[model samples]
Target: MEAVLPIEVEIPSMRVLAETELEEAEWAKQRCEQLNLIDEKRLTALCHGQCYQQRMARAFNARVRHREFKPGDLVLRKVLHITPDSRGKFAYKYDGPFVVKEVFSGGAIILSDMDGTENALPVNVDALKKYYP
Candidate 1:
């Protein structure tokens, strides 16, 4: 005996199964394409990141005015955390009108007190700003 439905009614399970198989095949194809493109995508992302970094560096360098210090130049050193001031948070941000005793090839300088007492440590030029007085 054969199962029968009304002429207007149709079994949807077969169509649904076929549609699901097609959908799965399409998904697998897309996944394979993505896997194949993964390396190229990573390289493109890396190139974009490097380009961004270079652009940022160029913009930064363009705005930067290089500071140069010579021996005998007077400058103020930024107060560091290692050297806490007695005044605490309200303390002055910079430490001296110290004299530049020695200039190094690298951006470092030796500082001296007004009395010409030289500091043993070398300070980065970034930490020192010129003292007008």
Candidate 2:
């Protein structure tokens, strides 16, 4: 970084090297030119990376569907593989017919059984689907 410095400034190094007055000025000038070139390259690289990321994000979200359900709506809760209902190969992925007892902020849903008792843990809306049957 010191090599790209615009002014004739003393550069401290672990392996100390002495610099003459004219040599120091020339080195400083070289450093100044290098600095601008490096900055332009850095800016171009950053902008290009950001644009690429945004393009990928747009493509990914293009087919994204939001999980929207109202309070009191019947919905299906997803059954995670960690706690599958059965050990068989044909275990159901979704285990609901649960009623949406309440809708909380930040997409969390309070769920209840057919008998109307709320479940222990509130479920995220994305983990649920509208009950078809």
Question: All candidates' TM-scores?
Answer: 0.70, 0.72
Best by lDDT: 1
Runs in model 1 lying further than 4 Å from the true structure: 1-34, 82-85
lDDT of each: 0.79, 0.76
Tens digits of lDDT, candidate 2, 37-92: 77888999999999999999999999899878887889988886655447676778
Error of 2 at 116 (Å): 1.2
> Which pairs clash inside model 2?
4-31
Q: How many pairs of residues collide in each model? A: 0, 1
Q: Model 1 residue 33 lDDT?
A: 67
